[model samples]
Target chain A: MATVSVPRAHWSGRRSTLASIRLAVLTFLADPQWLIPSMIAPIVFGFVSFELFLGTPDLVVYVILGAGMMSMWGQTLYGSGWATGQDRNIGTLEPTLSAPTPYVFVVLGRILWNVVSGLIGIVLVFVVVVVATGTVPSIDNPVAFVVLFVFTMLTLAAVGTVFAAAYVYTRYAGFVQNVGEFAFYIGTGCMFPIVILPFWTNPIALLFPPSWALDALRYASIPGYVGFSWGLGWDIVGGVATTAIYLLIAGIVFKRVERHVLEVGNLQEY
Target chain B: MSSVPAIEARGITRVFQSRKGFFYQDVTRTEALRGVDLTIETGEIFGLLGPNGAGKTTLTKILTTLLLPTSGTARVLGLDVTKDTERLRARIGLVLGGERGLYNRISARENLRYFADLYGVPLAEREKRVNEVLEWVGLTWAADRRTEEYSRGMKQKLHIARGILHRPEVLFLDEPTIGLDPKSARETRKLIRSLLGEGVTIFLTTHYMFEAEELCHRIGVLSRGRLAAVDTVAGLRDLVGGDRTIEAEDYGFEDSELAAVRHLPGVSKVVSEEYGPVTRLTIRVRTGDLTIDTVRQNLIGHGGLQVRERRTSLEDVYLDLVEEEAR
Candidate 1:
């Protein structure tokens, strides 16, 4: 495609989509029934971590923070992308496409809410875990943890984009949600740590960017935990590097599949 | 020249490949468009007339940048479809068949406003444009009702509003009035004519021959993926030598006499099909001027021949094209 100047009138498309995404996230959070349960999973796990590492005041905080961030990654995948898949299935795909807005912005707008929703889920879990358990981990490497989480989230977004595009072929976004949930369970260690998995399963989990991220978070924030063997912060460095690579790969693959499916006139056919 | 054709196609072609379902083995490739070349100058209503599977929808998709052509090129308002797709899409309006375009869950007003925003209409200008288009399509009264609750005609009217939300320079409407009642169809037709008056270039496709004849400045008859004919209504009618078909009750001409009548200097085709006790031969006049006298004199020479009916219209032109392709 030839490069052309963006139309002046549509310069705000990115902002519009982002705003819509935030609104969708806030709206979902506004409902206490959903908010309470989704947040509880991480805090309950944090309490267990606090009990296991007695006298380590920060263990509870680290586990809760890691779990909360990890849950957000899951929300970005299933929350935003799943909603887009529903629109595609219910025959709103063409109307959305007919608009003059760039396809990228449209897709982004559809799930912008998920990013907000994911953040809300994370915050709620953090507060509950801290207040209820009285656990506060010292901030040893807050910047590093933030960097790792952001990269991990981007990797999940790439996966979500591919899964949503694939929905065009599969005709079911629910399947993407199911796949994303399964991925979250194994890759993000929602139930347990990467070390607990079998040696072979570790490599499989490592394929996803989140595997190293969770390890890096636990290693950086928790006291006396062996995070990476290859020297100072190697796990954090390696995890970031691995996630960047996964994101690049996933982005390229998703775009290719989307183009192929759309060109074949099957984009909206389903 | 205006530097903008409302619509233009240069050697455009689209091919569709069919895949067999699981457990089946037959896969086929169907060519939906075969090198169709066409242009509709700014401010004219051009009708693409064809039967089902005639590639009209494929062409519409290419023009709207929804489907890329297999080969060749198309442009809407000087923007190449493949290259400046985003900009091109912003300027063009398209309405596909039936009530598929409108969102059933939202009220008609919301649907129009949603599209208005998507097209990048400024927040302030959006309301004005939305209201103008809604009133133009006469959907203001039902703007608040969910589209699903609206009748088919009302939904179609809303679809038209959604297409023109941004005042697109060129519009493509495919079979806009296919299933509407006569009153609704007439109202929509009148609305279209008014739009044409305002200099909106329209590329329309319809199965209704009369609608094309009544609305189109020029019509292209597509058949089996090729341009069967492209001309003004009168020009197309003249293609079959301006023939006037005669249908009658036992205007008894014997078989030998019918065969003799087929040999006339100006008569092009002599189709003998069963019609009650008599047979019907849809004769085509090969010459320019076809009067009742010319047809009468030609058939009078045959002793038992009699003329029962005569009507000259675009249907004869369409049938002629279809019959010529069949042969």
Candidate 2:
């Protein structure tokens, strides 16, 4: 009997992540209706935040940073997790889960797409606020402010990466995320400073990486800021620490959640 | 090749638990596989035949590493399915050809390319391999069309293309031709046959008895989570009673008349079913000594009677094995 040649299977983290990113781009291009809700909420919140922060001393900066963070939060916090929900809805979860690649990188690729989209959302919020208020806020350090802004989004990705596992853990992840949406806004101080919300809630808000990052963004961009009083260096340290912790938790959760789904055999269900 | 079976399953079982409504608060556990043990040699097509809800898909899913079993062990190509899922998945392929498993918005070529990358096809060979599989499944013509626009048959072909894209050593196909047109289904079968040359072991689950008879080196009949029988088509035919079957249709037949036919030499088993206004008697005979003439003469006085004789089919063998297990 003649033995036939069989190609040995190769495992590449880079290849899987790139393929997942390509899939995300292709899906968004084909049917972009999903981006509607993401866009609509941000535009509404941007206008509302501009009006509500009318007469504060650093009003433009507050409105711009607050509304931008709000809009970007929708994508970076929920969009990445929702993409995992989409995978479950379309029945791609089983095939992707069964593939040789670890599912975490697949979700990582998707979160990266949402991270880019979130940054774009911030720009849209910037334009919307600029057109509404005819005044541009001055950044004390432009490069630091921009770098911190991008870093803020990365902090959200860390949180989103951990949250994306909820979709794999249960089909009701969408419902849970929806219920948590406004709470996310409150806890992360998207529209207002967390210090204004109450002393007891501050500890809870600090648990989220974005809250720390958002505080650091305020210190860098807003002049005479008095929100945390911890200064820029401490806020950055806090952001880095919280984001690293969240990512570590994400890596551990994804493995357990994938194993749990395989054990339960509900990867077929949405 | 290495003397190890391509697939070796030992007492595999899966149980599903479903919880009822809020007021009821009851949990129901249904055992999908009781204890299934099977083995298939490398480069052979092994078909599993069963009625609906007969654990066929459960067993296939367990072996493919998509679902964990409640008990027992399964090894594919010398890799344990549970412990070595990642390593085993690259060496094996699963084709669940249907609308649900595919990315409908993308072209078939894109779907295969993504999967090829996931399977670790070298970047240089990915495009060529994708194109090669598209040609194999006869989807080269519509390779660029969004799969949402393709017919179910076309999607099925694309699925087969993806399954073989990385040249997996073993492929598990769950009802590969379930909803395809005859020509497309035949093409699918032909493509499956061609894979034998590459020494790909195939595990097929299908309700089409003739397909099992035509393609499988051996067939297993699963009944309500248990294996009723496993053998070559001829061996199963002999196990059921014979190579020939005789059918007699009438309004009805008295028990004594049926008993007389049963008492005839070489008659092995007798079964009767109602068809609207009339009843049909299916007689399984072990020898050529029993003929349609003999069956007709046995029911001499029956009116509006029609008699026919032909070789027993796999359907009959399958039905016999399943029904016997039910009893």
Q: Could you give candidate 1's per-residue lDDT for residues A19-93 as a string of tens digits?
A: 345434443544465554356654554565446545755656555665676566667676656555655655566
Q: Please, what is the whole-model Cα lDDT of each candidate in the order they appear?
A: 0.69, 0.86
lDDT by residue for model 2 (B1-327), tens: 668888999998899988889865898999889999898888889999999999998898889888899999999988999899999998888888777778888888889888888889999898999999999888899999999999988888888888888888889999999988999889888888888887888999999997888889999999989888888999999999998999999999999998998899999999989999899999999976777888899999987899998899999999888888788
Q: What DockQ does candidate 2 have relative to the true complex?
A: 0.70
Predicted candidate 1 versus true structure: per-residue lDDT over B196-248, tens digit per residue: 75567889998888899899999998887788889998788678665456542
The CAPRI class of candidate 1 is incorrect
True contacts kept of each: 0.26, 0.68
Candidate 2 global lDDT = 0.86
Model 2 ranges with Cα > 4 A deviation:
A1-3, A34-41
Residues A160-260, candidate 2, lDDT per residue (tens digit)?
Answer: 99889999888989998999998989888888889888899999999999998898888888878877777789889999999999999999999899888
For each of the candidates, give the backbone clash count. 3, 0
Q: What are the chain A TM-scores of the candidates, in order?
A: 0.75, 0.95
* Candidate 1 docking DockQ: 0.22
